[model samples]
Target: MDVQKTEIWDTKMVPRMSQFRAFQQVLDRTHSHWDLKNSNDDHYTAEVRRHTVNDFVFTELAADPLTGNRTISDIRQSDHHYFCLLYLEAGDGVLRQGPNESKAAAGSIALWDSTRPAFFGTHSQFHQFSLLIPHEVALQSLPGIEDLCGLNVDGNEGTGALLLSHLRQLHDTIDTIDTQDRPAILRATVDLMAAAFRPSEEKIGGTAFRRALLTRVQEHIIENLGEPDLGPQNIAAAFCFSPRYLHRLFNQFDMTVSDWIKRSRLFRSRSDMETPYLDGLSITQIAMKNGFKDSSHFSRVFKQEFSMSPRAYRNQAHNLRLS
Candidate 1:
């Protein structure tokens, strides 16, 4: 992330979270469970740049506290073991910080810069939503925050909550962020975040339509996977595409209309087979749901692809799931 260039991605959803967890190395962040008791990995990636440092803040409140007793997972960067504003927001519960412990409930904010270390303790399950923004982004306006660096901003009201509300909204709508509108959204959000620190907003740029269009297309496919009529022609019609033009799109993936839909149905059926939630769905029923017409044909195709009959596989899955 070159501070000179502008790039904003909302890597803030469960799918992105799984990807980040799978590839924490991209984050280049480090974490330390440098306090008392039970131990675990100090580092984990929360997003591309932002990291979550679990109990590091809480350790300040108490080495031992009243609660279910918690463990801190350092969600942070490998570079800059220290940061200016180590902010945290709670999805729920009472979080103790500084001289007074406050409940962040929902839509609340807490700020902590590196200089004066802050500690926190949460009652019940201490799940935290945190961000490690760049020092440049944090200290943009409140240079005096050097003195107030580690102090908690009363994010329960006014500017802080407003900023938090924005963060929460972005976090919630991440998967649905339209690429066509992303540049505008990223620009506005960056400016809004900058302004929250009461700093002059940074000049953000726009996105190219080509990339945005591709994103829009992928989103369409993912959202409509279950539509039995979601063949290339159907999709093309929905997108106002000519059949020939739609065939060109599938050609990129080296498949024609029918093959693509068949493979897609197989994949969805395979995914469902892994879950007990589909226990009531007979193999034929599941296949029919995904557009397969005949149970015997469905079984043969499934067995060839997965090395097992659909019922045998479903039974195995159910047994394993039970275990």
Candidate 2:
């Protein structure tokens, strides 16, 4: 619940000659240590309002034209390990992390990892919201988060739009929200951010990239197992891959996409059948809930997979629990 506001640089307080140095000191204290260059030293103006909500830090920054670079030395000397999610609210800029360089226009979000070197610059005056997410928390939500640095999350469409709206609302209401509720709200924001980032078409690189992407796709399928219309075509479309390419990706694991979906659904259904809390639901209800359309077909597949009828399995589970 701690909030800190810093007027990073003011033309009147700090003379033109000493403005850059004073700004650098403020930047070091308020944000990450960056090798900063003033694009408009003659007209320097910047301010920052920072709020610490549990493990996350939400910052609002407005500044004149400038560029900040995190060099190798800066990375090595700094102990900060976090991911920065920067949303440009008023102006555009170019952000570079690793070999990836992307344009971050207004209403767009860009991610950068603190452990790596990066470059950020704005051509004109800009206002932005930057959320500093601890590394462990970020990785827990999106294991492939590092790959997202230097990529743009389009805030105008889909989940990105939702995330943008959430961020703006959070910015407006953070002060009024109760301290106990801040953590939950921040966690939900992170989840929405992960969802927004995941659907973007990641660059298909070498073996490591492919392996990570495949794992992500599998995780996505597992999460959506109950969707009746979940199939290779839709899955492929969701991940921005062609159906044929998706099939090829699954083929590498000696599993077909349809078979994987069916097996996942069957296993999920079996688990639900055995759960005591789900006992009130009938067998056919459980089957259809896990994406099976016909009761007879669900029975045949249940037997094929678990060697038992769904009803018999549920009964056995209930008896075992009683014993």
Per-residue lDDT tens digits of candidate 1, residues 221-244? 556666766766677777786878
Cα-based TM-score, every candidate: 0.34, 0.60
Give Cα-based local distance difference scores for all models: 0.46, 0.79
TM-score of 1: 0.34
Model 2 earns a TM-score of 0.60
Scored by Cα lDDT, where does model 1 land? Answer: 0.46
Please report how far candidate 2 places residue 180 from its true position, in Å: 1.4
Error of 2 at 278 (Å): 38
Model 2, backbone clash pairs (residues 3+ apart or across chains), number: 0
How big is the positional error of residue 15 in model 1, measured in Å on the Cα after superposition? 42
Residues 91-146, candidate 2, lDDT per residue (tens digit)? 88999998778998999988899888999899988999988887756765664577
The residue pairs found clashing in candidate 2 are: none
Model 2's alpha-carbon lDDT is 0.79
